[model samples]
Target chain A: MSEMKWGWPVIGAALFLLSAFIPLIADGYWMSIAVTIAMYTALATSWALFSGPTHYISLASGAFFGIGGYLVATAMSDYDLSFWLMLVVAPLVSALVAALIGFATLRLSGVYFVIFTLGLAEMIRNLVSWVQNNFLGSRGLYVLTDFTEAHIYWMLLVVCLVIFVFGWWLSRSRLGFALKIIGNDEEVAKHVGINTALAKVLVFTTTGFFGALVGVIIAPRYSYIEPNQVFSPELSFMVVIMALLGGAHRLWGPLVGVIPFALVWETITIAFPNSTTFFLGLAFLFIVYFIPHGFAGLIEKHWLRLRS
Target chain B: MDILVSGFLLAGTYALIAMGLNLQYGVARIMNLANGEMIVLGALAAFWAFTSYQISPLLTLFLAAPLSFIGNWLIYKFLLRPLVKRAKNQGQLEVDSILATFGISFALVGIMVSIHGEYFTYSFLANPIEVLGSTVAENRLVAFFIALAIGLVLYLWLNHTRAGTSVRAVAVNADSARLVGINVDKVSALTFALGGAIATVGGVLISTFITLDASIGVIFTMKALIIVIMGGVGDIRGAIIAALILGIVETGVATLVDPGLTLVAAYFIFLLVLLFRPQGLFGRRST
Candidate 1:
């Protein structure tokens, strides 16, 4: 029993630490895959942080991510700001935007909330396109940052670490309990003296912050950033699906869901090119039918039954 | 004045899609995000049938609509029914259904794209017709009348027909309707069929007005959803009115402002409506 308590976590920590050094041994090709895994892990975890706990099903990650990319792009192009400065500014701006919208949106639940989030992302996409056409005078911004894949890999590693640590602590905190209660029943949460609305808005803002932070970090790693590319609903769908596939109810579920799927995605795109989205879509259908509870859910379902 | 006239004329075409979405979501509670793809089936079928066998797009409806109707019905009967049965409650059902439909969108959209090739597009030929001093594409006029005819028929059927009334009863309260001996399964399937048919017609009509490819499904679905939300979920009249307003807003922006700003205006209206009046313009005030 004691070994099960300490040994598993110890093994997990050792594995994560060992992965941190892979960038050293891994060539550029493998490093790219590592970076993708880390990015999706961070995104899926951030998605689970709000949607898993509150059951909101947000499609706003693409919006926040696009905003972050554009924000960094504009800051670097127009003002000659450093990537580091943009990093700090990105999450704050995204947080502010989220807080502004979350005020009204927090009132909605179920499918309406889902539509609102998706609509918000589309709205932002359109707004960015309009800005690009009028102000930027170009469809996309090119940033000539001299950062290597290794640098971005480390940045992604740190981002994933921060997100997971926060989620771990949140799962144990008073607010975590409050969030769970809210997800199960909002009316009960309110009756139990929780500030349901405030909790939702605050956590939702944090989710937006981290989602946008992915954009800020990834923008310089690429050659150019485009509004349509960054603000794609496909990105939002991937993050949400990844989180659910991993089992959104737990902190580690996203990591579990993202790693294998990210590798599979990379391989398929490399092998088949345009057929990846089709494969991904097929994958989604399979998940909903056979394993609606996700990887974690599958384990939990059997584990409890076995013990009983 | 020309832009206004054209915008409203375009609105006439969009009314069917919005109404279909309203029926699916408002009455059936199925949040079919593939509403866009539902129409695409018709568009692709019509296009394929027309190019392959010397038939007009209008006449292709005989081939396109029934196929889409059956496809959607199977989706409800086989895929959705079991999931709804196994779910804990409505909230869980909504979430699960969205994910499932999203999966369907991807799977089906992928298939459509692969078959037609993603970049393939075709246009219906039509001359310009002057309407209220504005010259519009002759196909657009044809599309407007087709859409209007469907909307009128739907409104009358929903208000007067037995199947429509049964659907309304099921929409109002499934348990009560079931207790009253309404065939819940039949009504649900019928609603899905109607929803599918109207959206297919919407797709068939819209394809004539612009160049269309497989990927246009999401755009149409998104438009119908926003309009459905705007119109108040269950109200047919509201869907019609909202569709017109959205059409006017979209085309008006495209004509009067920068073409790039058209989508921006529609989304802005969508967000404003979501924030202020989620019950929508014509929906009964939600408690």
Candidate 2:
């Protein structure tokens, strides 16, 4: 890779590594907040990797994330497996599921695809809830671990850094160009001999892998894992909103969206806890109407104007 | 036999739910994700009125229709009109409308929760009525008839009226309809408002039978979506039949198999239909 492509990830890695010292300097409260920020950054960035390019607007992130959490919780509670092994297994399984879903539903048009994904998440949640209620004789599983907030934060930061690097490489890759063409016009991409379905499914599967990995990394924080807790549709919507707000078109767009959103979300959670969804709805409306392309678009606009 | 009868009765309400969504998506070209919220809100209105003032749900329908009509008109006029204006193409409009409506659904749910967070059920016409030998709840019977009445009116309106024909024209080809001097924008907003009214009326009817809460709207939304797709996007007769099929399957699974698996069964059927006949059961594949 050229120096231009290599520069961002290196700088990003250094920043992530530098952020690992927060536990030593900050209180537990701040560390928790930092963990939340890192977690969202990882999720939004991974979400953007596929959705930004393809413009698919998937709401299945929560499904994959929940699958990851369930894998960890079920393994830890039922068997004597190592957390590390489950992490590897969780993302693989999630990716496989996502590939199946992608092949099945990606033929649908824009609105149908969006609704199908949201429906898929809801369907999985219902299935999981029913299975647990009937077969397991319990509502949820316990995942007891000794990992601190700071430890989780560091893990998430590392994940985010890795994702940024991967995304940076992907933007310069042939597949990335294919996705750009696909986003601009799938018919044009097909006429040019690009395999649109394969390209979409591959990226979607990668997103699933990352989504589940994030879930596994953060599972210990919850201690008890219920289907509803992990598979909340609100989480899916929030991730989409943040990624879009930051500009899913850019590799670093979700990071820009995640930071401000995480902070604001924290405030919303504290101020009017019951009305979080209300505020979330409002946030979506504003973003779509006023800043559809997100902060990345706005920044690029100003920068371009200045240069011109 | 009783399961079939019950399912048929259940289909009455489901058809109403799906029909409203069909109009919005088909005519207005706005897949209102908040469609279910409108249903829940109607239910809430009925529940509140019946419990507070001993008003009949039938009476509440008269109240909900105009209110929801006006409310939805305003939403279309202000919030969604700009989106319509700015969207470069149908695809862009779909994305914007979906996100916007999704947000609206959440906001409505939030508002509902803040006002009344508890599960609401009230005793209204709880007596048993004999339908073809097996007894069914009178409330269910009442809801079924009301749904039938509304469905008939809607079908007639679409088939016979000039205004409704214009709505259908826009659904078929907006640009062509515009070339013929039909105001596509006004027709769209009117159709959207009418759809909301129909959905709210459906809600008032269904509320008589089903227990409701603020968060249960998403389930209704999912079911309506399934029915609308299975029936085809813009087909009324197809929607009715599809709703009946869904109602039968759900009731059959709930009775014979585990009750909790009804939702799972519905989703399974949806997947099968999507895989095999994406254009819908009766709809010819569009070119």
Candidate 3:
């Protein structure tokens, strides 16, 4: 058990060490791709941490992620606050909002929760757009920063590592066990004396924090943060797809989904720019129909067959 | 007075769209995220027929409904059936169906964008007529009357027809429906197809006044979902009332406040309903 506990992290650490040097050797385009992969990896991973176990499938990642970007943009552009301060404040605010949303909708049936989350994201986007148009007198905010692409990449890598480590720790924690039980049978979990709502909210709050933090780190890449662009429902969908494709059930699953999807998406974007949405739609269909359990499930199945 | 008349006109069109969703989600138990795409496609077909061949939208409606009915029937048979069959539980089915339809919506949008690549609008009955001292567009009046006629027919059919009773039975309980010799799967598939056809019909009507693009499907989907939820899920009368309320609120907001805030107002009302009356305005709370 001890060996198993240490083995995964050691391999994870080695992989992290190897990935840390990509900026030094890769070309500009490749570095940008890596940044994209890293950003999605972080987003998908954090997203899976909640949706995976609870099976609630919150589509509000856009709201949280956009909040992060909007905060950093508003603070740096309007208030002239330091980026460092945003790093602290943005995620905290995201957690608060997520907790509110979680409490409000988590008790409902799964369908209502999904719909509410989707609506909430759209509502926030509309609200932001309205505010920008009416009061700000601009459609977007410029988030100019001295940080380079490599710096952003490195920060995302670190965030990825932190999330992975936290996820690893969480898997062995009491809350994790409670979450697993709730995911399996909420009524049973309630009878077993677990505060199911609290457990779900805590995990959701953490996911929101990570989602926002990624938005904060990635905001500089966009330079100009528009409400429509940053608060996009597409981002929320992509995060959900990537995570589900990788198998949200496992901690390391989203990474597995992120790498291939990000690469394929990059190719498709360049090759058939017009048909990207078409292909994206196809991707969702294929994943849901064929690989609903994700690659991780397939691997586990294969492993079990071999052993048997 | 103007608001009431215009609101009623708007509600007349929205009723078909919302009822389509009500049938699908309320009866078939599939929360089709692609519903808006179906609407857009219907609008596209109408636009194509009207502009390319100079056929009336009324004429195009006949072609669009049967075609969409067959298309959605096929979707249910091939794509959704597998998911429905394999889903271990209701929750699993909901998740799978939502994701699949979401994908379908994207695919539909992609196909539409490739084909049309622009907004579609046409002049259909653009003349104005007086209504209770205020002038309303002739097209909107026509749309209202047609919608009212269709809605009445649908209400009667659902309440009076044997097939409609089975559909309602499936909505009420699939297991009991099956026990009573009703083919649950067939009814579900038919209901889904009917929903799609109705949405297309609504699109044909809406396209008379509103301009449509490939990407505007999600907005309509959201609106339909709001109405379906606001009204009782399976109750057609509730959906009609909800649609009317939505139309009035939207028109009032558009006229009184900013036009851009109309969606905001609809969402706000939806949120209030969700928070305060999750069962819906006319629905009895489920045990």
Model 2, range B1-287, lDDT digits (tens) per residue? 88898899999999998998998898888889999999999999999999899999999999999999999999889989899899897778888899899888989999999988987688889898898998889999989988999899888998899988899999999999999999999999999999999889988988898889998888888889999998999988888999999999999988897776777888887888878888988989876
Sort order, lDDT high to low? 3, 2, 1
Mind giving the per-residue lDDT tens digits that candidate 1 earns over B104-173?
A: 8888788887788654356676788789887888888888888888788888898899777888888889
Chain A TM per candidate, in order of listing: 0.93, 0.95, 0.97
Best by DockQ: 2
- DockQ of each candidate relative to the true complex: 0.62, 0.73, 0.72
- Compared with the real two-chain complex, what DockQ does model 2 have? 0.73
C-alpha lDDT (0 to 100) for residue B271 of candidate 3: 72
What fraction of the native interface does candidate 1 get right in terms of contacts? 0.57
- For candidate 3, give the lDDT: 0.90
Per-residue lDDT tens digits for candidate 1, residues A1-308, read: 66587775677678779888988899988988888888888889988998997888988888888888888988888788888898999889999998877887677666666877765666787777777787768755776688888888788888888887788778888888899999999889989999987888888898889988988888877758777777877888889878888999888888889988888877888898877667877787778788877899988889999999
Model 3's CAPRI class is: medium
lDDT (10s digit) by residue, model 2, range A66-123: 9999889989988878899998999999999989888877776766667777766677
Residue A99 lDDT in candidate 2: 93
**Which has the better lDDT: candidate 1, or candidate 3?**
3
Docking class for model 2 is medium
Judge candidate 1 at residue B131 and give its lDDT: 90
For model 3, how does the per-residue alpha-carbon lDDT over B1-287 read when each residue is reduced to its tens digit? 89889998999888889998999987888989899998999899989999999999999999999999999999999999998899898888889999999899999999999999899978999998999999998989998888889888888899899988898899999999999999999999999999999999998888988899998998899888888888878878888889999999999988987777877898788778877878888888876
Q: lDDT of each prediction vs. the true structure?
A: 0.82, 0.88, 0.90
Instruction: Tell how far residue B41 is off in model 3, in angstroms.
Output: 0.8
